[model samples]
Target: MLVLEGVSRRFGAKSAVEGVELSIERGSFIGVIGRSGAGKSTLLRMINRLIDPTSGRIALDDVDVSALRGKELREWRARCAMIFQQFNLVGRLDVLTNVLMGRLNKVPTHRSLMRLWSDEDIAIALTALEQFDMGSFAAQRADQLSGGQQQRVAIARALVQEPEIILADEPIASLDPRNTKLVMDSLSRINRDYGITVFCNLHSLDLARAYCGRLIGMSQGRVVFDGGPFDLTEDVARQLYGLEAGDVIDMPEEMPAAVVAAQAATPPVLAAH
Candidate 1:
């Protein structure tokens, strides 16, 4: 379990996050939604120590996450992998080498710097690519792939880390509808099949409802609601978005045909628990 007690962050006179508290159980697929600057990204970054909380504590399974430093902090980060809004891949590197970078913490610094990976490490990386149906692109440059394909390669990189928790900061914010569905499906599969805890920041209420088992609504640096997808009624959405009821009532319910076709073309691979 992960616990945040009175967590808050401030930049001089402004507060990014304030007095936030949450208890996240293992294997939960949670979606954090809010308008821009609602502090969604800041909260996720604090959990992995990417950003320090100005007040309160963050704990994971009874370990004080806020207190870790140096090598300890690095190890904690390895266990809690982060996926960015922009697929953070080395464009010039071959897909396989990019995936292999996940093993940097486990391998010696010298070997990693020289890109001298063992056969077993190479096999593991390849297996990760296969899981996402990107095995054939292992030798291709990351920059050459489409946005959807590049995102899959990013997922493969995260999988090779063998992380206990995955924090996705708007993983599909930049993708087209088709690519969005594919990426969301991949995340859902990872959460369900591998039992990896997933905390994602999402802008679209529809996509959040479709994939996440639980939704956490934030407004102005505070949690406004915490409940299942079905519990997120029209009123709740309005409150979450800081909009009038009519603004949210007209939201789309169905996935695009392109997204459906993409999903059909690539059935998600269930990761081994």
Candidate 2:
């Protein structure tokens, strides 16, 4: 389990996150929802140790991850992988090489610097790409792919890391509706099949309701609601988004034909899972 106790972060006088307390179980899919500047990204970054907390503790399985430094910090980051709103891939590198970058923490510095990937590592990277239906594009440069394809490639890279936890900070924010569904489905599959815990930050209440087992609502850097999706009442949502009483949240029903075709083309390796 990952536990956060009184965790807080201050940027000078401004508090990005404040006194967050929660316990996340293994293999759970959680979505953090709020309006802009609600500190969802800051909270995820604190968990990954990309940003340190000004007070309180973060722990995974009884280990004090918040205090870890040097090699321990690097290892913790590898164990807890992060996916961003932007698909952070090297434009010049081939898809295969980009995925192979996940193994850097496990391999020797000299080997990684020289790009001396072993056959075993290559196999793992290939398997991940195949799962995401990107195996055919292994030789293609990352920038040449469409937004959806690039995001899938980024996911494959994360998969190769073999992480216990995936911190996705608005992963589908930039994609179209079709790609959004695909990305969410892929993350869901990973959580269900591989037992990897996923913590996703999202703006769309409907998407969060569809994909997450648990919903955590944040407002002004503090968690005001944490429960199952069904427990998120309209009143609470109003408070979370700072909306008026009668204002309705837009819930669009869309499943593009392209999404169906893409799913059909996804390899059986992932479909079975």
Candidate 3:
């Protein structure tokens, strides 16, 4: 389980995150949805210890992850893998090589620079590819695949680590409708098949409603709503987005204009968990 005990972050007089306290179960697929600058990304960063909380603690299975430093922190970070909105793959490297990169912590830095990986690493990378149904693209360079395929490769890279938790920061924000479903489906599969707890920050309400078991809404660094998707309502959405909710949703132009514009606007509505 992951625990956020009164986590807060402040930069001078501006507070990015407030006293946000939440607990996530071991296998829960949680979605964090809210407006931009609401501290959704900040909260996700704190889970992996990429960003430190100013006044509280984050724990992974009873371990104080936020307090871990140096080598210990590195090892703890290895337990959770992060998936970015933009697929952060080595563009020039083959897909298999990119997935193999997940083993860098276990390999010496010298060997990593030389791209020397053990046979086990190759096997694990292959297994990851198979899991994502991208085995045929193993030899293709990362940049050669389409955006959806690239995101799948990134997911494969994360799975190769066998991490217990995954933190995805608006993972499908850049994808088209078809690609978005593909990426979200892949993540859901990972959560069920491997029992890896997924904590995602998203922008689409429909997508979140479709996939996540639990939903969390944030605004200005404070958690406004936290519960199951069944608990979500128009009233709750209004609370999350304020007066702009109706004006925004009532906009008309295309079939998916609401989501298309939302994705393009300042205060985004993300999908996850």
Candidate 4:
């Protein structure tokens, strides 16, 4: 389980998050939605230790995440992989090499710097790529792939980390509708088949409703709503977005049949405890 108590972050005089309290259960697929500057990114970053909180504590099980430093902090990060809006990958590097970078935390610094990967590690990286249907592109440059394929490579990299939690910040923000569906379906499959806790920051309500079982709505750096997709009525969405009812687009009742079938076919993997 993950717990946050009275968590807040400040930048000079501006407050990014304030007095936030949340408890996230294992294997939950959660979507954090809000307008620009709603503190969604800050919240996810704090959970991943990419940014320090100004006050309060964040704990995973009994471990105080805020207290970790140095090698310990690095190890914690390895367990909590982060996916970014702009798929963070070395454009010039081959896809396989980029995926191998996930092993950096586990490998010796010298080996990582020299790019000396063992056959087993290479095999693992290839398997991760295959999981995302990108195995054929292993030798291609990351920049050579399309935007959606690049994002899949990013997901493959995260999978090789064998993380306990996956934090995706606006992962589909730059993709077209078709690519958005592909990426979201991939995330949903990972969350369901592997039983990995997924905390994603999303801009589209429709995507969130389709993929996430739980939705957390934030406004002005504070959570205004927390509930299942069904509970997010038009009124609640208005409150969350600070918009008129007519402006809020209603989400579909169910995900596309293809996405559901794909998830059903995914095989379960052992996830971190």
TM-score of every candidate = 0.90, 0.90, 0.88, 0.91
Model 4 alpha-carbon miss at residue 63, Å: 0.8
lDDT of each: 0.85, 0.84, 0.81, 0.85
Candidate 4 residue spans exceeding 4 A from truth: 244-248, 252-273
Select the stronger candidate by TM-score from 3 and 4.
4
Off by over 4 Å in 2: 244-273
**Which digits, one per residue and each the tens of the lDDT, describe model 4 over residues 2-35?**
9999999999999999878888888888889878
Residues 1-273, model 3: lDDT tens digits: 788889999989999889887877787788888888989999888888888889998887868898899988887777889998888999999999999888877888999899888898899999989887899999999999998899989999888877899999999988899989888989888987889999889877667756777788998898878876545567777777777565423322332433232221112233322
The candidate 2 region of ten consecutive residues with least summed lDDT is: 264-273
**Candidate number that wins on TM-score, 2 or 4:** 4
Error of 4 at 121 (Å): 0.9
Candidate 2, position 85, lDDT = 87
Question: Which digits, one per residue and each the tens of the lDDT, describe model 2 over residues 1-273?
Answer: 999999999999999898898888898888898888989999999999999999999999979999999999999999999998888999999999999998899799999999999999999999999998899999999999988888888888888899999999999988999999889989988988999999999988867767877778887888877876555556666777765323424533553343322222111110000
Provide the global lDDT of candidate 3 against the true structure.
0.81
> Cα lDDT for residue 17, model 3?
89
TM-score, candidate number 1: 0.90
